[model samples]
Target: MPNAMTKTTSLAQRLLRYGLYAILLVMAFVYLMPLWVMLLTSLKDVEEIRTGTLLSLPGSLNFDAWGKAWGSACTGGTCEGISPYLMNSFMIVIPAVVISTLLGALNGYVIAMWRFRGSELFFGLLLIGCFIPFQVVLLPMARTLSFFGLANTTTGLVMVHVVYGVAFTTLFFRNFYIALPKELISAARLDGAGFFRIFWRIVLPLSTPIIVVTVIWQFTQIWNDFLFGVVFSGFDTQPVTVALNNLVNTSFGGKQYNVDMAAALIAAAPTLLVYVFAGKYFVRGLTAGAVKG
Candidate 1:
């Protein structure tokens, strides 16, 4: 009787586990449904999209829509496609990420290691930037950019992103740096290693995890930004996000669903790829300093 009861309990536990797995599988499918639709739609022509179900498989792999989205689809009034705007995004994102990351690292280093008067107050003030809404700064930023003759330029957009990104990057680095051993900085100082030397040698090498976190964070934010890109960039400097919006909205002939889907996918591809490749690092970095701050 005891053996039979134990077997029954074990079977119940196994069934429960299977039930949990089934729920997880269902939730995952629901979450991924949109991506599934987009991929299918992008691969299908307009005819298939109109006649077939959203989940229907494409009759054949089609590259025409991808090609059009990349090089020939009209966005706004331009027929040059998203390629230029995509390049513009790259131009904006790379500089913005690098400048913001470096500046954040330096600022964090100072705040975490170098004590000075009003340092805490200064950090508090800096933190304010992280919470400020994008809308709140638009007018002021536009005016500032105009004053500096940077309005409607890729350079201006880069500057805007760097300024906006710096606060978060600084926060990440500061939290991470504060968790690091103070003894390392102290020993380096006692050894007569200067600020730059210690930073270049000891601090920076130890900063890899945080650096990855900051880079991924900033890259995703800056790359996907639509409002800033649309507002600050001129026709020639519009980022891929803006171009994708225009591509979808522009009414020329019949609506091209496949091209729109392909363009959307293209715009999203970079951030997706970044996450796919470096997602583990992002999570690891976040946890590295979790215990302290």
Candidate 2:
């Protein structure tokens, strides 16, 4: 009787475990349903899409949608497709991420280690800037960019993005660094290491996790930014997000559902790929720095 009761308990536990696993699997499917639909839509022909059963197999697998999104899709008279704007997206997002993350690391280190007079105020001002909406600053930022002859260009978009990103990036790194031990930094300084030396050798090397965190966050933010890209960039310098907005908003001949889905997916592809590939690093970075801090 005792053995039978134990067996029953064990079986019940196994059943619960299986139930939880099934629930989680269903949740994951729900989350990924849109992507699955989009992929199928991208593969389908216009006729199949018009039939509007998103789960159905494509009557014919069409790479043409991919081709059109990448090139030959019309945005007005231009047929350059999403390729040029996709390049422009990279041109801006990469530089913006690199420069801003680098500068943010510098700012965070100085505030954490140095902590001199007005440094608090400086950080406070940055904090305040983070609260201010980008829209409120748009006119001033555009004016500033125009003053620097960078308005309506890729360079200008990068500059604005970096400026906006700096405040948030500084916040991330500052939180992380404050959690770290002071001794490692203090000892290096006591040994007559200059600011640059300590940062370059001790602090920066240890910042790998925070760096990855910032990179992933900043890269995604900059890549998906449509407002700044549209406002700061001219037609020639606009990113894929803007082109995608155009593609969705303006349709001719017929509403090309397959084409629109393909374009949207194309616009999101890089960030999605980056997240999938870098997700491990992102998780590692968060815990490593936080534990040390």
Candidate 3:
């Protein structure tokens, strides 16, 4: 009787496990459907696109659309394609990520380890920036940029991203640092290490996990920012997202769905690559300090 009951329990657990797997599989399929469609559509010719349903596989692999999207398809008034705009996005993202991450680390180190009068209040005020909507700051930012002779420039865009991204980066670093052993900082000071010296020798070296998280977060956010790119960038300095929008809107003779799909993929490739490579690190970083404070 005991053996029969044990077999019955085992069967029930197996059924439950199978049910969960089925549900997850369905969810995964739903989420990946659009990407599958985009990839299929991008590889097909215009004729195939017009004739085939979204799920239909292309008869033959064609890369003409990808080439055109990269170098020749018209974006707005220029036929230069999204190549230059892609470079512009990289220019903005790299500097913004570096500056924001460094500033965040410094701010976090001070707030977390170097307690001072009113530091909590200062950190609170800084946290407000994280909650502020990008739309709310548009007018003020435009005016400030214009005043500083940076309006519609790539450098201005970089500065804007750096300022906005620092809050979140600071939050990540502060939380991570707060969970660290204070003895480390104290021991370093006892050893005659100054602020920057201690940070460089100890804290910063141990910051790899949080840094990966911050970099992935900032790179994804800055790289994928469309509204800020469009609003802050000049014609010549437009990012790939803006150029992709223009490419779709400015089609001359006919709407080329394949080219549009390919351009969209090109614009998204950077963030996708970042995630593909470092996504596990991102998850690990988020959980690194979870067990402590």
Candidate 4:
């Protein structure tokens, strides 16, 4: 009887594990359904798309839509496609990401490793910047940008992204640094290492995981930004997001769903690639950073 009971218990646990796996598979399919639809839609021409359901495979796979979307799609009166705006986004994102990450790292190191009065309060205030609604600052930011003659330029957009992104990056680095052993800093001081030397030689090398997280986060945030891009960018300096919007909203001969979907995929591709490649590091960094502080 005891032997029979053990067998039944093992069978039941196995069944439960299988059931959980099945549920997870279903949830993943649900999440991926939209992406599947978008790809399907983007492959079909306007005629086939009108006749077929969204989930149906294209009767004939068409690559012209992608080409058109990338090189000749209309945005208002301009038919120059998304290529230029894509370049503009890269320019803004790279500089903003690098500048913000560097500043955040310095700020985090000082706040975490050095002792000073009101430092905690200063960090707390910085955290508040992350929670505040960006909408609240648009007017003031615009005014300031105009005052500085940076309105509607790529430089202004980069500055805006860097300013907003720094708070989160600083928080990430600060938390990760807080978990580091204090003895390491003490030993470095004993070796007559100053702050910059200790940071460059000891701390920065150990910061690979958190640095990956900050770069990925900042890249995604700046790349996907539309509101600031729209408000701050000029006709010549608009980012991919704004261009994609213009392409979708422009009243052409007819609504080109395939072209719009293709444009969207192009706009989203870089960030998706970043997440796919560095997702493991992102998770590790978050876990490690949260372990202590």
Candidate 5:
């Protein structure tokens, strides 16, 4: 009788597990449907895209649309394509991400390990930056950029992204550092290590997971930013996202959905690749940081 009951329980457990798996599969399909549609639309010619349903497969694989989008596409009078804009995005994102991450790490270390008078209050003010709406600062930032002679340049865009990105990165590192054992810091200090020394030797080595998470987050945020890019960047300095927008909205002949989709996909590829590669570390860092805090 006991053996029979155990067999029944095992069957129930398996059924429940399979049921959850089925639900997750459905959810995944639902989420991926849009991406599949975009890819299919990008591959199809204009005629097929206009006549066919969104979910329908392309009649034949064609690389022409992708090529046009990448190289020969026109945005208004400019026929330079997205290549230059893509380069501009990289130039902006790289510096912005590196500076923000470094500053965040330093700020987080100080806030988490070294307590000074009103430090918590200062940290609280910094945290407020994460919650404030970007719109509120847009005009002020533009004015500041003009004052600094950085208006309408890649450098200006990078500065804007770095300022906005630091808050989130700081939060990430602070929470992660807060969870670290205090004794490790104490021992380093006792051994005559200073703030920078301990950070360089001890904290950074153990920060791989959180650093990966921060980089991925910052990369995605800065790469995908359109508002700041549009406002701050000139034609030559424009990031890919702004360029994509211009390409899509350019009324050269008519709306070419295929070209627009291809451009978007190209623009989105880097952030998507970053997430796909570092997704494991991203999840691990979130979990560990939350648990430790």
Candidate 6:
């Protein structure tokens, strides 16, 4: 009787495990459906994409849409395609991420270690600045760019990113720095280390977690940014997001869903790849900076 009961309980546990596995498999399919559709649509010809059932395979597989999205698709009066926009976006985003992250690190170090008058209040104001909606400040920023003769240029877009991104980045760094050992800082100070010298040699090395978080956050923001690029970057400096938007908005007699999908995928590739690869590090950084002290 005891042996029979044990077998029954083991069998019941196995069934429960199987049920959970089934449910997870179904959930995975549900979430992946959109990406599956996009990939299939990209392979189909225009006519096939239009007439074929969404679940059905294309009549003929083709790479034309992919090529067109990357090199030949027309955008209104312009047809230079997604290539130039890709380069311009990288130019805008990379420098913005680099400069913002470095500045944030320096700000975090200064605020966490040094004694100054009303430093907390000043940082509190900066924190408030981050909460203001980007739309609220867009007009003022645009006007300022114009005043500086930087509007509608790559530099202008980067300037906007740096200005806004700093608040968030600084918060991350400041919080992370606060969690670090004050004795470490005090020792360095007693050794007559200047602020910049200590920051370069010691604090930065231990800030890997915050740095990864900052980079990932900034990359996603600047890469996928729409409003800033559209408002600040003219045709010559527009990133892929704006270019892709133009492609989406310029459909003619029939929509080129395949080409449009391909363009979106191309625009999204960098962020997607970064998150998939560096996601673990990003999460680790956030956990480490969670105010341990």
Clashes of each: 0, 2, 0, 0, 0, 0
- Candidate 2 lDDT trough over 10 residues, lowest sum: 284-293
- Model 5, position 223: C-alpha lDDT score: 91
lDDT of 2 by residue, 9-90 (tens): 9999999999999999999999999999999999988888887697998877898998987887876557777888899999
lDDT of 6 at 140: 96
Which ten residues in a row are the worst by lDDT in model 1?
284-293
Model 2, residue 37: C-alpha shift (Å) = 0.9
Give the poorly placed runs of model 3, Cα more than 4 Å off: 290-292
The reply for model 6, stretches above 4 Å from the true place, is 1-23, 290-293
- Compute each candidate's TM-score over C-alphas: 0.95, 0.93, 0.97, 0.98, 0.96, 0.92
- Candidate-wise lDDT, in order: 0.92, 0.88, 0.93, 0.93, 0.90, 0.89
| Cα lDDT of model 6 by residue, 255-276, tens digit | 9999998888888899999999
User: Residue-wise lDDT of candidate 4 within 1-293, one digit each (tens)?
Assistant: 99999999999999999999999999999999999998988999999999889989998889888999999999877998898899999999999999999999999999999969999999999999899788988999999999999999999999999889899989989999999999999999999999999999999999998999999999998999999999889999999999999999997688889999999999999999999999999999888773358
lDDT of each residue in 20-117, candidate 5, tens digit only: 99999999999999889889999999999889999999999987889999998997669877988999999999999999999999999999999899
Comparing 1 and 5 on lDDT, the stronger one: 1
Residue 231, model 6: Cα distance from true site in angstroms? 0.9
Quote the lDDT for 245 in model 6. 90
Ranking by TM-score: 4, 3, 5, 1, 2, 6
Off by over 4 Å in 1: 1-13
* Model 3 CA lDDT for position 209: 90
Instruction: Rate residue 41 of model 1 by lDDT.
Output: 91
In terms of lDDT, model 6 sits at 0.89
The residue pairs that clash in candidate 2, if any, are: 179-293, 180-293
How far off is model 5, as Cα RMSD?
1.3
| Candidate 2, residue 218: lDDT | 94
